[model samples]
Target chain A: MRLATFRGRDDESHVRRVGLVLGQGDHVRVHPFDAGFDLVELLAESAEWRDSQADVAAAGDGLALDEILLLPPVYPVAMRDFLTFEAHVDGMERGHGSPGVPDAWYDAPVFLFMAPHAVTGPYDDVAMPPDTERLDFELEVAAIVVRDVSDVTPQEARSAIGGYCVMNDWSARDVQGKEMSLKLGPSKGKDFATTIGPWVVTPDELEDCRDADGFLDLKMSVKVNGVEVGTDRSGNMGWSFEQLVSHASRASWVKAGEVLASGTCSTGSLAESWGRNGSLTPPPLQVGDVVEMTIERLGTIRNTVGPREESVAPVAPARRRSRLEASA
Target chain B: MRLATFRGRDDESHVRRVGLVLGQGDHVRVHPFDAGFDLVELLAESAEWRDSQADVAAAGDGLALDEILLLPPVYPVAMRDFLTFEAHVDGMERGHGSPGVPDAWYDAPVFLFMAPHAVTGPYDDVAMPPDTERLDFELEVAAIVVRDVSDVTPQEARSAIGGYCVMNDWSARDVQGKEMSLKLGPSKGKDFATTIGPWVVTPDELEDCRDADGFLDLKMSVKVNGVEVGTDRSGNMGWSFEQLVSHASRASWVKAGEVLASGTCSTGSLAESWGRNGSLTPPPLQVGDVVEMTIERLGTIRNTVGPREESVAPVAPARRRSRLEASA
Candidate 1:
């Protein structure tokens, strides 16, 4: 079952829905739920929830998956992403024509929280901040937690995983690389925005396929403005999702909606491989450049890059006073 | 206004009256909202909420602050604490007998969300995890976000703050320091459990003292088994709460109800300074250790560490068919 969050046209409110692709593959059915409702709560009450999802997939009669917008599957309580891939690290260094990788890069995985508000529908225009000239995309898989887990073993970790989703761990490479060297991480860089999903596929649907090597499957690609910059298998990770989950779950508790993304895969995206200081000089996504990312068995998400409009809506003086007094 | 979450004995819940200490002494009064309802939501809604709190305080007839049990005030979306005090960091290093701080230590303030499930009420019998050999306390102040903020300037940052509270960012020091070098952060070590209480004081009650020093001039002390370990001031910080909020709000959206803690103060508590391993070894809180933490102008919270006991209740087995289906 592929689940997604969409913004309704008239109301412009967020809704969670399950996508049912029709037999003709031309359309899909969207079953929406109330705001604040989550599948985790439903699953917690009874296993029937999973059975219903399967039943719906079997009875599919609906719209094309591409017609709808996609928001990140997990409304994460906490979003912790780690940079554990050495290949991507080396590729980044080599791409910059640098001397070598930083010595500390190999010791531990560098991680950071993707800013929570950067969430957008899969089809929403990816806003390119004026300060960030270089924007890149990385096709990766994200792990979703189904239940509260603490100090989980590798095997326990695998069972705790709710499902997988295709994630475009969007990047401002110039901002990331420069600030990361300070040893803090991409606090302001990759955190600015991260994109995920056209859909999230449940684990049972991909039975026996979540192996370490299978996870690193090399069949993913990133295309920017019709140019392919990164292509790699999923198995390229130094650590599997299970290991990452196991390591992350030690002592600390992880709630149902957390997202743990695999760092960029080797040559996974072109913008990161070619971006320069505050410049998206190569493979840059312009106002009309449609960025398309796809993973095998999971589908493709297409997003357009455009100038950021002043969405800081105008505030009338009276309304401002009222708001101030109300919150004051 | 001092707000509290308490489970009254009559099987009745009250979000009504909470205790507050004023110039004359302690008094109890009804907050303008029902008990058990999230206090953070109320704080975020009205600045006048604090004004109403003052009204409640003024009308207080003869109540006392020490007579009630206290629970963590705000419901946190995410709790990110920073080790920003140079002295506290140095003391931690000294406790570990380490030569110098790791490179990542200078990294951005490392933070982790302590499990919300671990929260206990003030005056409530605190329980220790059987496996933990060390339990420690940290004396600090926490800032609550009153409004939604993103990419805010420092000046705007100060306005985003809703209120403040006393927090004991408890730690299993050994576990934390061991894993921190691995670059993950004080995940297991510092956040296994966290205790915060006895009440929250809104910003209206806290006069602006930033002109004197970037600190909260709260006099605080900690005691174990009625023995004084250390004392410190809240204003002694490497970065002020305003700075932390500003840095955190940059490109990072902080929602109402979110909490940011100013790690521990220098010599503020035994766990942060003088204790072995920065924590009392055999860190178990015995049945009689009366732990008291006080913040000048705020109040003091007294909690007694108690022995663990079994309290498991019987559960009816699920219907047979349901069990069979689950097994299947």
Candidate 2:
């Protein structure tokens, strides 16, 4: 079953409501739940709750999909994106003149925390950072944690995932490269905005899509301004979603409403594509260009590049002090 | 005025209440506001709200400090820790065998997003990550955003800060060094736990502590297991809290209740101390060790390192697929 968060197009209060999507394509409709039916709260409940909610959804005569504005399905309490695609890692290393992937890559499923406040709706416009010239988009899939757990095994972690959705981890390449050179962060570059949604597809609904090894055999792709940029299969991930989730909870608690994303697939990002082709053939994204990302069974999320705002004032250098001078 | 979040020690409901800290040490008390008064909501209000609340707090006979349990002053909706101390950065580079600080360090106040879920109270016990043998602590000060602002100048951003608190950014150096070698994260290394608070001291209360250049002239220090390991003046930060907040707001929004922290000070961490002395002088933190961080005017926070838990099952390598084989 597909679940979404939305508000009526003309809503003055802008109250978000969880809904169950019905029908398909042009005939799509949404069965809005009661005011207290929060998506995050629902995700935290047992499977019995979902079964009961499906029954309630079947009894309603819903509103047409076009009558409402879709919001991001969940406001993640914490968000972490993992580097789980070996091909993407290898290509990125080669792009920077490295021999191959770092040995550290094979040690564990490494990840970076993302600013949850930067999340936006699937159809929202993404503003380019004023200081960046090379804006890009990453195509990937993200899982929503269903319950709180800690020090859990991969099998236990697998059962804790509530659903999946398409995600676009937007990037400002110039800013990311510079800050990363300091070996500390890619914060400002990736914190400007991240787009997620269309809707969340429950794991149980996709059992048929799982291969013999339990990896999802889903096709993922991204397009810019109607031109296809990259494509790859979801099954290509070096670390499964369960492994990533287990690694995250190794010594810390994984809370309900937290999000863990499968990092960009092979050729799922412009930078990786440029690395493989050895050229910036399509150029970087610009204002007014549309970015569309799709994953099999999870649906699609589309966003347009918005105009860049004026840059903030430059940070002044520290005053030279006797203490600093002495240390230098 | 000092603000805090607390729960009655014997209360089974575990309801958190915003309070005003009153009186001096040993005779201190907390005047709990009505149930409707929330710290986060109050921070987002106009100055008029704060003025009225102060009058209300002055009229109440409050509860003794020992009658309640203190939580982190605020559960920040988002958290960022910035590298603003040049001494710490230089020491870190030297420890890594680098010539000096990266040129990019001078461009902007760089930061990384931190897991808000990992936040613990000032006096809480922090569990060491099971995988780490080289645990460490960082001494710092953190500011809380008082209002929502976007693309604000440093001067404007300064007024948006409501109060300050002491912070301890706990780290697993062994885990951090390995992951940072891949240049994407310091996530799991630092995400297990971060302690902040005693209570938040309002900016108005610290007027006498400001230096001629407007930098806070507060003494900061850290001690482990009763031994003083490091000390520095808060004024030595290369970028002011205002500058860090301004940089954070560039092309993004800084929301009330969010936190921005000054990264480790000079010799604040065991690794940095080891670098300066050319040895592991005090040794890494171990279970049962007490870590105390103090910033003058902001108060002190003490935490005991707890025992580590068992590690989760290891993540397996990706299966060799025909698609990956072809690519290789």
Candidate 3:
């Protein structure tokens, strides 16, 4: 079963409804739910999310999905995106004179916090920040935390996942390099906007696709306009969701409704390709370009790149150097 | 005028109310306000927050300030803490082999986001995470963003501050040093909890104290069990709140109700003093210890260090190296 957030196109206010998405694209139906705004709360407060599956699935009382605007499934309490693929890590950092993935990456997953106010939905138009000359996209999968968890081993961490969704960890390469140098963040460089959705699907829904390594055997691909630019198998990650969740929970409490996102799949971002020696780069995403990614069972998430409003300007270098440049 | 968030003793729920605090210490009168949660909203939507100040000041309906449980003045939409004091930077990093004060601290202000969930009231218990062996406190002043800011000049940024609050940027030295080694965070090391309050004072209230440096000349002090350990003038910060906010607003929008925190004042924390040779290290905070910080104009924010619940345990090293240890 798929869960989604939607609001009638005519609604002037931001009141959105959580609902069950049933049927295929043209036949899609949405059954408005009373689960409040938090999906993790819905899943944790009662077993109905799992036990009343058939009741929510009965679509007679639902509205057509096309008549509503989709919002992010939930604006998370805390959101984290982990870097676990060795190739993506090596591909982005190797040319810069840094050693490939640190021994630590293999030991346990590492992730970073994301901006809370910048969440966008699958279909939203993401405006390219003026400072970012290299606007890029990262194809990823995200898991939503179902309950409070801490000090849980990989086995126990398994119960932490409520669902998975298509994610676009949109990035700005130039700004990212500058901020990462400051040794603190991929701050405003990454804080602009991150998109996730189509809808969130429970892990049980993909049980039939599990591979020997305990990851779903799913084909993931990214496209610029209509051409495929990157592809990978969802099962290829060096880290598993369970391990990532377990690692994150070891220190602080991983609260319910928090998001644990898989970092870019190998070759998932244009910056990696640009850093790949001798590779021909796609002209950086321009206004009006459509970017889309799809995973076998996870569904597709599509977005349009748009120009930031004229009033939005890059802070002048005269005022502040990326913390790294200043330190040097 | 001072604004605060509090809940009545009779309520079993966390039904906090925004209010005005009038008078001093024992004579303090609290007039519960209905102006909604976001102080920025209260300041931005109308001039009444400033213009009608006299009417609200009349003592007709109010409760004793001591009768209510005070919470963090506002739980902001986004929180940013800046590394503005060169001394604090030098003090925290010099021993780690990091060259003191990255030139960037002098050039432009840099800040990192804090977890929204971990914010607590001025007087709340700060549970020391078991993983943090050297828990420390940073005495800083925080500004609440009053309006949406993007690409604004430093002068405009000045108008963006809604009020000021005393901030305690609690840190875990072992965890922070480890994470910074990997070049990403200040995350889990700082994600635990940050204390702010007693109450927030609008800039209008501090007109008499504005210093030559543009910051209020507030004397800030920190104490453990009633013994003063550190003190500094908040005005000594090398970077002003205006510069920090302007620098932050340069690339992306700084939303209303977001927090812009000053990095610790010089010698504001135990760790900084520990780095100062011959200063006996204050034992790292343990459960039951009381830590308090008082700022001249902003009043005092006192908190007890509490033990994380027994069930709350740090993830085992077998799972993930504290990002710091591996990098070293």
The candidate that wins on TM-score is: 2
What digit string (tens of lDDT, one per residue) describes model 2 on residues B196-274? 9999888888989887777877899898887788999888887778888888888887888788998988878999977
Best by lDDT: 2
Superposed by TM-score, candidate 1 places the C-alpha of residue A79 at a distance from the truth, in angstroms, of 2.1
Q: What tens digits encode model 1's per-residue C-alpha lDDT throughout B1-328?
A: 5555543333355543433434433444323233334666556657666557556545745334443445566557776666665567666666667654444444444444444444555556665533345666777777888778876665677777867777776665555444444333544445445666666777667776442544566777777777776677665555667667666665556777677887777776565444446445434455667777777755666677666443222111111222323655
Give the worst 10-residue stretch by lDDT in candidate 1 chain B: B312-321
Q: How good is the docking of model 3, by CAPRI class?
A: acceptable
How much is the TM-score of the A chain of model 3? Answer: 0.90
Q: What is the C-alpha RMSD of each candidate to the true structure, in Å?
A: 9.7, 2.6, 5.5
Ranking by lDDT: 2, 3, 1
**Residue lDDT tens for model 2, A187-227:** 88898898889898888888998877788779998988888
TM-score of each: 0.72, 0.94, 0.83
Candidate with more favorable, higher TM-score: 2 or 3: 2
Instruction: Give the per-residue lDDT digits (tens) of candidate 3, residues B1-328.
Output: 7888888867797687777788898788878765444555666655564557535544458888568888888777678877766667777666555767665445445567776667788888877775667888889999988899877877788788888999998988777766665556766777678898988888888888876546567899999999998897766676667767777776566888788898788788888877765343877787888998999989998999887754333333322223323555
TM-score of chain A of each: 0.79, 0.95, 0.90
Chain B TM-score, structure 3: 0.90
List model 1 lDDT by residue over A1-328, tens digit each.
5556654443354455544332322445555543455654543333476567546555654334444555666567766666655666665666556654555554334444555556555666777753466667777777777778776765677766766767777777666655443323454456556777766666666765555343434367877767776776565565667666766655456667777787777666765456333344455555777877777766677788767644222111111112323654
TM-score of 2: 0.94
> Highest DockQ among the candidates is held by which one?
2
Q: Candidates' lDDT values, in order?
A: 0.59, 0.84, 0.75
